[model samples]
Target chain A: MPFTSIRELLPKKDLVGFAILALIIIVLMPLFLDIFRLNLIGKYLTYAFVAVGLVLCWGYGGILSLGQGVFFGLGGYCMAMFLKLEASSPEATAIQSTPGIPDFMDWNQLTELPWFWEPFHSFTFTLFATIAVPVLFAFIIAYAMFKRRVGGVYFAIITQAIAAILTILIIGQQGYTGGVNGITDLRTLHGWDIRTDSAKYILYFISAFLLFACLFAAQYIRKSKLGRILVAMREREDRVRFSGYDVANFKIFIFCAAAAISAIGGAMFTLQVGFMSPSFVGIVPSIEMVIFAAVGGRLSILGAVYGTFVVNWAKTSFSESFPELWLFAMGALFIGVVMAFPNGLAGLYQSYIQPWLKTFINSMLSKYQQYIPAKFGLGKPAQEAAK
Target chain B: MTTTHNHKHKEMALYIEGLTVSFDGFKAVNDLSLYVEEQEIRVIIGPNGAGKTTVLDLICGRTKATSGSIKFKGKELTRLKEHEIVHAGVGRKFQNPSIYEDLTVFENLEISYPRGRNVWGALIFRRDDEVRKKVHEIAEMIFLGDKLDSPADLLSHGQKQWLEIGMLLIQDPELLMLDEPVAGMSVSERKQTAALLQRITKDRSVLVIEHDMQFVEDIADRVTVLHQGKVLSEGSMERVKSDPKVVEVYLGH
Candidate 1:
């Protein structure tokens, strides 16, 4: 629940010490690498942030929602729209405002700003739009499906359908959304020095901080009653339902959480990349997010981060080098890991690292059972578990 | 003249009336009517495919009843979902030791407390001291106190059953419906399990569906024999053993 081992390693009392450790490490990032490399690393963090929700939804919930990219796209579009509007001077606010057309569209023959795109021009409104839209969509869909008790393969099909529809809508809305090309080009975060090296580093820090926060939040929930119910739904849904909990509410809540997080991650990605395209938020990307978690460790929060980094690193390093079969290589990795270690890399850690750690702790406890008296506290958990 | 329904006169923990479960037209549990009393260790003993589990499935909300009513603790259980039934104080233990085998025996129980069973509650780590103490007490009672730190899969078969029973115990349900709790247990383990069940039955209602008649005889307060998806006879084993119809059904001659 608490990332038990990490929490144990860094107890609440010693948190300050770890914070200082993190600060020192972060400060050293610029010292070891050039500004260009720092930006690259920062870009990676944005991708990791975007993948966080997918990890929770697919890895823990087993929903296999193939439409998470919809949220990502929404968030990205929201951020891009706000940045684009902010770029235009106040003097340019109402100048005939090209009708039924984006600026790029105006370059063709379109004349007026689509009414739906009007609200997004405001920074604050766009911010809410990004998060609220995705969460709202996810909530409605999850509620309808879960309330009716549709899950497993059927749930998967419905979500994939949603993604397909979203992809088509975004591509076809030539007068509303950016169409196939998607909103892009201009960028700046509230007119801050977006091109500055410090800004890039700042974004990277925020991404890392957000990742840690989400992990912490997920871990807490996993330890809490709500997580147990979800697990119960996964294992014995009927039991949880008879217990008086509305299983639909539980499913919907997690579904919304996943979508909202995915949206925020998408916003971060858009901010970092200075662009948005329909390709970025399609079924392919949605499936890829799930694949990352599956190969890392479905249920482990830390494993999700591990997975996002691993798969992305592979793609970045080798996709272009052997473009003819990069997907083949990626597919091979997925099959290989799933076949050999269903737990993913985290599973690898659990199966291998955990045993070693347990033995070490137990041995330490035995030696210090008296005198130092290791706080192994084994019996307490057992007695409690039996209840 | 006013008359109360004679059937509802008997207060029951579980009231099953004409519970028919049809699979594509064939009756899995046909015209099955049975009542389990509060705290009664009612054993449903029937041969394989006699719909012994179908009854539990219907009761626990695993399988839908085509036409019947199941009222547990005066609440209609037929309409409730599985997890809701669990919260309504009915706990189900599967034939397969259904636990995260990779998790430590204690961790499994840690993740099973009946509190905060919502998505928001799960995201917030709120551990009540009382639940923790109860878990400890259950683990000790189930004789798994020694192996608390060990992963569940590594535990012996008997211990795993004890652990699962412990999980059900933590919920502190009004009724614990266990299926084959001691199916493959060793003689010593069976004896230990029988002792555990006896201790548990003191407080909660237990309905065990077991194939081992000796195990059933060791634990059952009353036995109900089911045949052709119907309640063939209900009485003490000694009395049911003497019933001609029950004998014919069991012998199948």
Candidate 2:
């Protein structure tokens, strides 16, 4: 009787319905947005990818890996490198209305592309590089840290340092790496006309689908025993180990997956936005990733995507709409959500909609039963008996 | 193999031959050899520096043996990782309360619920009616059938300990190792825990490290006194209690 009743309170089936609803909303977004609006939404969805990765590593795994932006930048730079290379051939360069190097890189006196920049001229290689680069970086770092048993604030410090160092290194290498300006002047991907409305719409839809994929995969993992193990590792690594699980392997797995997700987001982002900069890999963006996951609700995957969308929407709408007062609005929003809705939008849904719908449905069912008796002329007899 | 284990019992469930565990340069557990038999509740009593916890560490694979072999059920346990040791039927509970506090009592059990000990199978584990029935059956055995709906943190110290033991039991390890199981408990609670341990050892071996002599005397099938990283004396509770060395070491007589 204990679990029999307790099990009924669980939301497993209702959660599926919500996921289906989310998918429908995502699939139909392009129907409403124009090319320009779709491009903007695609950019937002790309950032949602970074948020999804953050939720996996920092939220679920208890690894505050601030260097996700380093992987993000790595992936973005790899894609930007390809786009820039494709833009820079003498025949290709002559066809561009503006110089491929831009006026600034040309002023830096760079005539040819760097050696590492050569192979990325092909789209296939850049796409491969995007996922591979982050996975490789995550593998090395997680192997060293988790194996050595370095945890707590030490993990945070080390990952943050990686991002800080990457940003500085990129900035210091001005010409080949583009320094602070960061290898811009990207015009197209795979020689396609990026300015075309249909092409841009297709990109937005691709981003939406990919976001759904990442979100679904993340939710599946969380619902699975792996998520529980990762949470167990976060709370007590020694206990999970004592329970007969390799805690480090779980950490490395989630960390690498997160890095790969961030990398994909970065690649998608640079392609859609036409720029990559050292600022993208800096400490601020790294902090923003954690804040989004925390403020959104780290436990839920939808919370991660939703958090990213809300934070970014605030940044886009309020910041752009208000300009100078954007930072204050964002701060207020963070404080408000953390104080009022500690579990993020997911908490809001649980508190407001879940019980209400249940009760409403129960009422409707009873009314239907009452109406059926009347339809058969049984209601009058029943009412008279009750009186 | 220059090392020779000098213990009399050859049929020991746990046999440590020349086991040495050191952190940095200091040896926490010296080249110490010990043996534990099946279904015996062996209480390891020791002073602050006696390395009682460290011995548990070396046995459970939390701390590596510098140059030694740890054998469990006649299998060399030195190369096995922590999870592998547990899979090999060695369960360890830490000195601290390590139960998942945020999750419900049932959820804590569900998280620790056994399903063939493979990641793939565990990942795909859904609500199998049989597994649920078995879990509830185990819950009833530990007297936690009524408390399953409560969050883990809401349980009393004794209940939490029982819940942790229950979590280990569903996996059904052959050897259950606990560090300070009754470190904090009332008289009735300690008695209840003692009864639970007695019930458990019917099918599994228990190694408990406790500072409370009364709690140890109530449950320990045998007592092994550790002094400065070595076994000072080990025998039946009455035998160890009356030994001159134990009196001298513990009571300063």
TM-score on alpha carbons, each prediction: 0.84, 0.83
Clashing pairs in 2: A244-B83
C-alpha lDDT of residue A133 in model 2: 83
| TM-score of model 1 (CA atoms) | 0.84
**C-alpha lDDT of residue A262 in model 1:** 78
Classify candidate 2 by CAPRI docking class: acceptable
Docking class of 1: acceptable
lDDT by residue (tens digit), candidate 2, A1-387: 112332232355436544664664465556676677668878877877888888888778888877778888898999888877766766655643445543335556766555777778677888999999889998999999998888779998999999999999998878778889997877777678555777777666677777777766676677666777777778877888777777787788889888888888888888788889988898878877766776677666667777777787778877766898876776676677768777777677667876676566555655565557455653443344346
lDDT score of residue A257 within candidate 1: 81
Off by over 4 Å in 1: A1-25, A88-101, A105-110, A152-154, A193-198, A223-248, A294-300, A341-387, B1-11, B251-253
* Best-fitting candidate, scored by lDDT: 2
